[model samples]
Target: MALELDGFAVLHRIGANRAAFEGISSEVAKVARSLLVKLLKDKRTGVDGVRAVRAALGAEPFALVVDGLTDAEIKSIAKRLDKHNPVLIDGDAATVRKLVGALADGSTEPASRPRAASRGNAKAPKSKKEPTAPKTIARVSFKSAGATRGR
Candidate 1:
């Protein structure tokens, strides 16, 4: 599916119910905006943005963000950035929506904290697989290079 993170121009591309997409996008944006606010704090608001973002997207997503991004995706996005103008840089809503739904529905559970190492016990509890949101790429083009003349 063609995912449009900025402006949602191709929202219909996902084939999900329109209402559902709207709702999901709203929730995703809520979590993202809160995070941005926290990361770029305004003194007048005096809000702890990170905590607020965590509460909105839940602990798992927050932890994922805290854990940081992969070097590969970062490099890819950086390379793409050189070619395109960045209007908005936020989490991919479709991906984030799926994550939120998984979290809400309990289909995907967050990883458990590691147990303290013991000398007698060498084996550790199996860690639940960490959930991931799709990396927000830097280059998102609205139009193709070739275009028809005005009618």
Candidate 2:
């Protein structure tokens, strides 16, 4: 189905019920947003289409993305993100656009933590102070006139 907007188009196909999938799960939202971004990068759709998608879903793209989408739509979006056993239906063009907007705005998720880059030769942290230890006597003995019973 054509998304209502002029520059939007659904990029994935799924087998789900739009109404049933009202509240978006994080996994679904992430995949939807990611796929939306991928669609933006595609040459077929061009920049205008990408911009339009980003605008529609600005604050809550997942909400708008799944507006008319059913469970079938969910499966469709899922398939586009996945590489195997693709979903059985297509996404609503309008929803895809909104999803892109939402992904760009980033209202739903925080930026992911970047992985620590591995170094071939990493240096250990330098020590600020030398390691010091306390000294202790092996034993203490009291010497008195007859304290030990023998001088």
Most accurate candidate by lDDT: 2
Note the Cα lDDT for every prediction shown.
Answer: 0.45, 0.48
lDDT of 1 at 62: 55
Give a tens-digit lDDT track for model 1, residues 57-97.
Answer: 67676555533434433323222322121211344543443
Residues 1-151 of candidate 2 have per-residue lDDT tens digits of 8657532233232214445555655556677666764564454653345345656655465355445355555444433432232112344555444443344454423224456798979898787997679788687565554565545
- What TM value does model 2 have? 0.24
Give candidate 2's error at residue 76 in angstroms.
Answer: 26
Candidate 1 residue spans exceeding 4 A from truth: 1-47, 69-151
- Candidate 1 accuracy as TM-score: 0.21
Q: What is every candidate's alpha-carbon RMSD to the true fold?
A: 30.8, 18.9
